[model samples]
Target: MSAWLRRLRPGRRTWLRLGRDAAILLVVYAAVSLWQTRHLASGSAPALAAHAIDGSPVSLDALHGRPVLVMFWGTWCPICRTELSTLQALSRDWAVVTVAMDSGDAAKIRAFMRERHLDFTVIADPQGAMSRRWGVVAVPAGFVIGPAGQIRFRLVGLTSSWGLRARLWLARGGF
Candidate 1:
């Protein structure tokens, strides 16, 4: 073997340590991430029927021809606040509705939305009943529902706007 190749090879001890650290990191990451998403429904969304904060009736069964973004958010959650922009941007091309989990009553949510300049549709989950029904345990959790009423993807963290748009596009068979 070439001297350079021999020099580049790590010693057995170094390799073992590196492998151990990597394995540990992987396990830790999996545990944390699973905690965030393990409770979310995987294939299809649940029967959702409620009134929007604006008093509009919201039923997922009625939105059959367009992809819907079901977002779970809390006013006090920093991650949810930060991810709101992505949701707003995606609202332009898709059906985006957020469930305000424990954010307060309709009046409070209206004021918060006005203050934040968030124009997307919102459903009030003042008691978190809707969120619990949706199987959402984490703030900022997102579920992409296809036009045919199937959940195409589930996002448990701060997902990018482009990632959401791409999922919507693919769900529409835009490929």
Candidate 2:
């Protein structure tokens, strides 16, 4: 074997240390995630029935037969902006309903949606009343509602599209 290759190989002890570190990091990440979502809504989701910015009616109760992704976000939130595409993509395969928490009036939200080319159903919560009922104090909060109308997962902050997809799939399976 070449000297460089031999030098690049990690020893058994090094591998063990790396594994320990990874485990610790995972624990820390999980703890933080739990802490961040401590105040989020749980149990049965709050009643959400409103008109989308596009004039279509939206209601969480109507989507009870299938898992639904309910997201609370704002146009001013950069993290929420980054997740727009993810939410839009998920809407194609699953039911997605978003609350624009204090984003703006219906006209402004409609403009933002047009600019981003997003077709996801968005209900404007200009006064944040809907978000308050959902216990969402932060932007970019997400909930995976099971087919039985229970909240299966509460996610705070940014989350990967695949992670959300997995949660939706799990919810569908009655998890």
Candidate 3:
């Protein structure tokens, strides 16, 4: 083989190595995501009935005819902060009920919401009782509950607005 053809062999090998590395990385990511959400609620969602920080009644059962996004987040979680805007936007068009997992008392959460100009309904889980009940071990956990009250999807960590919107749409029987 000529020198030019011989040099091309290493380039082909490099591409193969890059592809293998990418595949491995993707597998690792899938494994970690699965492990992180292993204990999360599934099938029929747990009963959630509580008063919002504004003293309004918020019940998952009330939203039984439509898909609802139930999010577990915290004021102290930086990643959750980044997702707050996405949640606020989603709340405008969909049912979004967020639990402030160990964030603080109702007053503190209200203040945080006010500072962020966020109007999404928040249920303060100061003692993490709600989080524990939902099997949420970390912040930024999201669950899409279908109209029949079944959990349609569960996501952990930071999720894009489009990603969340798609999940809610899917839960609503949208293709």
Best by TM-score: 2
Candidate 1 C-alpha error for residue 4, in Å? 13
Quote each prediction's TM-score. Answer: 0.80, 0.92, 0.88
Local distance difference test scores for all models = 0.87, 0.95, 0.95
Candidate 3 per-residue lDDT over residues 65-126, each given as its tens digit: 99999999999999999999999899999999999999889999999999999999999999
Please give the ranking of all candidate structures by TM-score, highest first, separated by commas.
Answer: 2, 3, 1
Q: Tell me how far the alpha carbon of residue 60 in candidate 1 is from the true structure, in angstroms, after superposition.
A: 0.8
Q: List the residue pairs that clash in candidate 3.
A: none
Residue 6, candidate 1: alpha-carbon lDDT: 82
lDDT of 2 by residue, 1-175 (tens): 9999987999898999999999999999999999998888999988999999999999988887999999999999999999999999999999999999999999999999999999999999999999998889998999999999999999999999999999999999934
Q: Write the per-residue lDDT of candidate 1 for residues 1-175, one digit (tens) a residue.
A: 9999988998898899999999999999888877788888878789888899899998998888988888899998999899888888888879888899999999999999999898888998988888888788888898889988898877798888888888888877788
Candidate 2's displacement at residue 144, Å, is 0.6
Q: Each candidate: RMSD to true structure?
A: 4.2, 1.9, 2.7
